[model samples]
Target: MLKSWRRRCRRKTGGMPELTIPSHFLCPISLHLMKDPVTLSTGTTYDRHSIETWIEAGNRTCPVTSQVLRDLEPIPNHAIRKNIQEWCVENGSRGIERIPTPRIPITSTEVSEMLVRVSEASDESRCREFVAKIKQSAKESDRNKRCFVANGSTKVLSAAFAAFSNADETVTVLAEILSAMITLTPVLDEETSSNLSSEHPLQKLVWFLRFGSLSARRNAVLALRSILSFDQFKFEIVVKIEGMVEALIRLINEPICPTTTKASLLSIYYLLKPTENSKGIAITLTEMGLVEKLLEMAVDSDRSVCEKALGVLDRMCSHGEVRERARGNALMIPLLVKKVLRVSGMATEFSVSILLKIVRGDEGEEERAAAAVEALQAGAFQKLLLVLQIGSDEVSKEKVTELLKVMNGYRNRIECVDSLDFKHLRRPF
Candidate 1:
């Protein structure tokens, strides 16, 4: 009967050879096909426990290739862990299955070695494959995947940044991250403004803000800044505003960190610009007593920071209430006027352009017109005319025409001691 059972089993297995032992009983860890499998100091094969220890120590590299083992989180050793647990549970009432386990086609050690070699590889095409794998792993929800990205090692960030440095690649990555934020925004909790993680997406955003390249920084700022324009993300928006304000305050206080300071100020400008949903931001700024702080920054010694702060104020000035508040403060106007006069000719032109918006309409027409006329009468027009006169031929004649138009608007109010030739003003000279 046993011979008949064996014959029947062989018949069921078809042309396959008879199994001496069932494959499932074998240890998957030792069975994994590692080209150069890690061997411990004890000369035993490197097992899951050893790998986990190395990973916990933040050594995520293979011994051979020094390639990053992105999948560093612990996994249950199916052979040992399950067997021990079953033995404890059943007290060996059921013997372990005699199945022989098929080896995993690749092991963590092999993958790490391969990745390290790929990282140092000179072949652009292969490097691209490595980058794709890293990004792919980042998108997964597996604990291992999360640990890999959250590792925050310079190698991973550098690799990610370098991969997307090309304009098209950068745009693609930005679009993906933006889309993910939008899709995930709705599902986020309203009260806490946190994402699935305890640290909100904005915290991740701050990471990018601090470490990303110039273009990447710009893109990140633009994305987070856009969220302030939507009411649905109000809580998230507040988080960003807080982050921005903190960064701004730091930048304002720390003169040593100029690049970060300038970047942060520029980011704040983009974040706090006037928009329908950003009315809350204005209120928040006011509540935080940021108006004085912003005004001080507008006159900062650093031209870039000062110019950016001026831009933020200019945008804020679009709101009548904000404008009135700034104007009533008494300090902003003189500072703005000084900026208009103190900058180089082109910068002066930009400052004047911004000032025009403040003084544009009939609502506060007289006050605004008086300010412009004061600036003009203070020889601003003459300085501008001089720029038009002596600067390169590249000067926009239309800008010259615009200046003449501005001067002409007040021509009737001011008496001309000397007859000025409009025809000469019309000429390029």
Candidate 2:
């Protein structure tokens, strides 16, 4: 029976001889042989990657035993790692490769000392060396990033950036500092976020977006997105910053890459989110030609880009000025109609909501009727009916039903053939 099992394993593995992995050598979280095993406070061993991912996802419990973890720190289980290494060596002919020893994760103390070194450096060359070291440590792993955040690295980096940003000679060091700051953004605590959101750091990021390398600009936008997500009050601060909105809009207008484009979209979406202060922001964005840019992106792109572009347009169109801007665009109605039921459900909903807002005519019933006629001419009537027939989420269905009613009156205005030209039409029948 054992031989038979080995033969079956060989067949499945494309002919490598089979060797059983010791049950103890497997991580409870992954059930794969542990590469770098660590012991949690719960006395359970898990692969470092698996446990770190779990902890990073905000789970405080031991994945296997369901016990709350008192200590978030994972102690390396050297014995199990050694045993796994030995087993791999013994099974060398069976194609098992030994796992290399994993580097130790940085501790908060190490990160804090590194920040101090960068701060106390007396010369530009020494500062650049220290900044490069910090950036390298941040790039190494998510765990190091968390360590950096925990040590208030964001505040330190912000101060460092402000000090060095004026010196064109220290441009390399400035870039290095910005790169490290970006990694720490993902895990920033409230204190760090507040420090980074101060006027100097915020302006420096805007500067980078405008003048930095393409890679630097992408990092700058990502850092902004992370910082903005921390609090709603920061939106007021950001909108007031000179060139902040324009920088984000320019990225969408001439994207460095798809990633930068999406980041910019999300950043704008966050800024224009409905709040007491955001109404003016929508008007600002619309005035800056953002409406035209979003329409162009939504007209044709990958599903993700389409969804995000339409989503921002949906939010922006909530304001009267924005709706007017969208209405003036020749492609607005047709683009929204095309996106409906063509992209994902969220895209469909956003497109429908924007259409509903545009055609609702808070401006005047005459304007609303005119827009409905435009949608009808653009084949929105057929698309709405198809959406209802195919089924959709409650929001989309409700909006589509409302649109159908509005456009129903204009149905006769749309020109259609009186009869089928069967002479050229091909039919299976």
Candidate 3:
């Protein structure tokens, strides 16, 4: 009957028949055909994507009814879906295609239940299995991630990590749990921060940095960065942990991967970033030989790594001891000069800040003059001029002017320029 009706309609129009779709088949939100129809608590049906997007935008009221969604869960309108599919099959020649069955979304209840299983597992193997399952579900789609976040997976995983005693199997399970928790960091609440900052979980994260798999190490650094960002007071306690700074420095010194290397650099920056409460962190990091590692990273061709390395170096160079250490490295002055105006604005700012610190050292006038001479030989004099000409932030501009004055005072006093300075002078002409 549908075919004969289509034939008659086509014969009248002399082309494909125009089938009028039922109003009920359209989503109330999108006003398009409901491929995967789901009924909201307000008894209005919308396409799954439409409603999910609506709710994700923080809307609690249904679009059609404007009624409060007491239960945010959307029930699948299976009968309407089946009808839509049948209609498409019947109108196959009318440029309509059947909708495929939608995958059942993981619910918050399921996520909560999974977390419960993860917390209640009896042994390492079972715990590992449940944690892996959670990781898999979280990786499946964005909806599942929202479900995990809504279900408080971050707190549960952090608690699980703290519960484990030190063992190879336990470390393995803890690493997996940490990896899973890393995905749930869309927002870090106070409770989650408290849980992660506690002794056991913090130690486990540090352990992962030193001994976990490559992915685990990367996840650990990212997790630490988030925790530190969420709570700044933890810095004082975190730096005191044994081997915490060393492990991060190792990752920087012997990079596992670009991601892990950058993450470690960022984590270190969070620690050594100049805060009134964090005054000693820079000293501690430099004493652990972080200055040499940062100098090595500053020269990396990857501008991101170079920028972060310079940012940390700038922060550390605020200290007289760190400045002395940096100036001691033959490559440090030249690296800072090369980065100015060459990498990025942030990079140039950090590079200029470090150079300014170098030339303005607190040791003595003799030490400052010697550092100024080194800057001149490193081609910093010309780069400072370019920064002024090319236009930079007011702070960098001022620092560039000061750096040029200091280097100029020493430039006339020095007789020899390094090959780098000679090269720079010839290239621009």
Number of the top lDDT candidate: 2
Global local distance difference test of model 3: 0.80
- lDDT by residue (tens digit), candidate 1, 222-310: 44444333445444344443455554444455433555455555555655655564566665655565667777876655667677666
* Cα lDDT, all candidates: 0.48, 0.81, 0.80
List the candidates' TM-scores in order: 0.41, 0.71, 0.72
Clashes by residue pair, model 3? none
User: Candidate 3's error at 366, in angstroms?
Assistant: 4.3
Clashing pairs in 2: none
RMSD of each: 22.8, 6.1, 6.7
Question: Regarding TM-score, does 1 or 2 come out ahead?
Answer: 2
lDDT of 2 by residue, 1-429 (tens): 235556666787777655677899988878888898999999999999999999989999999899999999999999999998898888665556778988888887788788899888767788878878877887788788778777778888767876775555666777777777776674445554566676666777888888889878988898787677775445777878888888998898888889788889988888877788789888888888888988888777899999999989888888888888788888888888888788888898898899999988578778788888888777787778888998987877898999788788877877622234356777788
lDDT of model 2, residue 338: 81
Clashing pairs in model 1?
22-99, 22-100, 23-99, 23-100, 23-101, 24-99, 24-100, 25-99, 67-116
State the TM-score for model 3. Answer: 0.72
Best by TM-score: 3
